[model samples]
Target: MIDDKLKEKVQMLICGDLEAGEKAQVELLINESSELQSYYKSSKLSWDNLDNLAGIEPSKSFVTDFWKKADKEKNKGFRFFDFFKFNWKLAGSFAVFFVASAFFINNYFSDVNSGFTFSEDVEILNQLDNAITLNSDSSLEVYGPW
Candidate 1:
């Protein structure tokens, strides 16, 4: 039933080049010959099946490794100290010392201005005694009559 000539024509008609007269001839031939019609039906089904299945290509197990790599990259955490790469401890220590020195110097100057030293008060008392002795009425009064 599937002779070589009709097979060729079936291949062409499947590819969409057959004219209306050619299709009508094929249809008339199919109705009059029962075995030809069955063979043609099966071949037409095969052609239609191939046409429906075209332009679809599936890759093999494509997502497993891709997802694993993505998860690994996602779980990698950020390092907080990465940007300050050099002399981090030195910078921190310098900042601490600078702040302490500023605080100490400010307090030292403030204390110096607010408190009186013992030596300064004793010198002032001695100057007052000398001035009083120079203005006394008698030699015995050089030292005040205590």
Candidate 2:
């Protein structure tokens, strides 16, 4: 991997900003290392291509137009939640979903039996009450202090 120091040195070498000694050292390093040699070659090719490209001359109003657009955007305050603006359609759909789900659940359960007849339910309640009374009486006798 190319290190930050080596990358900076390579950039400086490409830009012709390195001193004579630094340039010589970078050149030697590039010559000795295949990775550095490839990196330098690609960098030099890209820089040469960029230099040879013809520059586009912008219209005189380009700067003014750009600033005007920037100012307009700046004047319109930015909010992170603006992208998540609530839609009434979405809310209505969610409401419809919940209502439909509730209706389905109610209809499903309404058809199911209570699993116990009325008389059976009354008998079970009575048995439960008797069991609770017996338990309380036994606990009192067992835990009573002398």
Candidate 3:
């Protein structure tokens, strides 16, 4: 098998892309190596086949039909229902996500302030048989119904 460097040079030579000095060097090597010579012939044949290829022409009505299709699409207006027509799954997922987020927020993250009670001190005070009052001189006065 030919080495990679020599094979690349041979391909470049077949495509006429090699410089003058490189072309002469590769040609001399090809003449000496039988394997390189056969490789060069096959590469040249492939290149010639590619060079002979011609593009197929479009049908006579292709341009007119294309323009008619383009104009029809251009005149068509976008509708709100078009989003659901092609993307029902995406819309459904969004709806499910919104419902799940609402449930999680309401159930897992309920209002902590609503659970608090500021009337506990007053309830305890009412439970006492005697009333405890704070005097203006920072003294405690215990009094009852008298």
Candidate 4:
């Protein structure tokens, strides 16, 4: 039986999880010891043989049935709970879309002028283009000299 420390390191080496320096050190140690070399060889062979095993593929409906069964088991005796288990992400996205549509429609089709008008502000500024003064007796009223 391989010791625990060497067995663990051998597994790490076989799985390619060891650093370059640690891998070189382990290889050197294994080469110097016949018992470790034999253990590493067997471990490496077993690991490599795993890739040669055949893979089993499930039917296309296997995942659908699996989730259905899982959901059924989750709400086994409480049928009312299933009604509240719908996708929150889909519901939240729809709520956001409706809110955004309402906001856009309110702003775009409203008769009230509640938004900023850059042209109006620029006209007001142009009316006082050179009316600013730094005098103590002057009052800086809107769009007029005082």
Candidate 5:
């Protein structure tokens, strides 16, 4: 575990903010401890290297170009119902299908021999008689004469 006091003094020493007495104490500790010596060397090297990297000013058009590209990307993102622009064509096709189906159904049902009829065919009447029976009182009341 690192000693917090020593660490603080080392950081102040690296940043050139330690007083003369504190700097002497920290130097003594650093010289005695191999870990403190290594830490001090690395921290000072990093600090000196950072000083060599001077800040560069961006070009005049950089901000405007950045905003234009950002605006284009924002516009391209998360559009709802974008594919629905062609839905009118789908609606037209569905209308045509329903009209054709209704036309066929109407013509089919309108034919003379199309739907159910009370037939005079004995075999069909016998089949119907076998399948149905006037068993319940409610059925009799509905089907029977008053």
Candidate 6:
């Protein structure tokens, strides 16, 4: 468990913002605590070495170069639809085929159901011939004046 006073100093030390008294306190805490010592050593190593990284200096164009590379890599990222366009075309063609099939089936059933009407010409002709023959076959006569 880190003490409150030591915690404040540790934060200042890591941030490189420790005052003289804070630095003394941070040193004492680090000397007494293994955890604090480890944290301090790592912080010191990184902070102290950062200034001497191969004596390397950044150019004025570093920021522009960083942005250019970042933008290029971001644009190179795969878009969601680029790999699935062929599937989309296949699905579209399937939908069109399904719709046309439905239309043809509806027309075919409608023609069979509604366009096939009953034809009465043959039955009517047969009935008319029977009536003429029955009228002509009256064997008996009328009792009164013909």
TM-score of each: 0.32, 0.36, 0.51, 0.40, 0.36, 0.27
lDDT of each: 0.77, 0.87, 0.81, 0.81, 0.81, 0.77
Q: Taking the tens digit of each residue's C-alpha lDDT, what string does model 3 give over 45-116?
A: 887899788989999999999999999977887876676787989889978999999998886455444663
Residues 63-116, model 1: lDDT tens digits: 887888889977876655553468789768877999999999998787688676
Off by over 4 Å in 1: 48-146
Task: Kindly list the per-residue Cα lDDT of model 4 for residues 43-76, writing each as its tens digit.
Answer: 8888889899989999999999999999988878
- Model 5 residue 66 CA deviation (Å) reads 14
The top-ranked prediction according to lDDT is 2
Question: In model 4, how large is the Cα lDDT of residue 84?
Answer: 44
| Model 6 Cα lDDT, one tens digit per residue, 1-146 | 66776666776877879888868877887899898888767766877887876766899999999999999978888976565667988768877999999999998797678756235556777889998877766633444436
- Structure candidate 2, residue pairs in collision: none
**lDDT head-to-head 3 vs 6, winner:** 3
CA RMSD of each candidate after superposition: 23.9, 12.8, 9.8, 12.2, 13.8, 15.5
In model 6, where do residues sit more than 4 Å from their true spots? 1-8, 14-16, 51-146
- Cα distance off (Å), candidate 6, residue 74: 32
Order by TM-score, highest first: 3, 4, 5, 2, 1, 6
Positional deviation of residue 95's Cα in model 2 after best superposition, in angstroms: 51
Clashes of each: 0, 0, 0, 0, 0, 0
Roughly what TM-score does model 6 have, to 2 decimal places?
Answer: 0.27
Best by TM-score: 3
- Badly placed stretches (over 4 Å) of model 4 are 58-78, 83-146
Better of 4 and 6 by TM-score: 4
Report the C-alpha lDDT of model 5 over 1-146, residue by residue, as the tens digit: 56887787899998799899988988998999899998888888887898889999999999999999999988897764554457988767877999999999887677646554446456688877766763454567876686
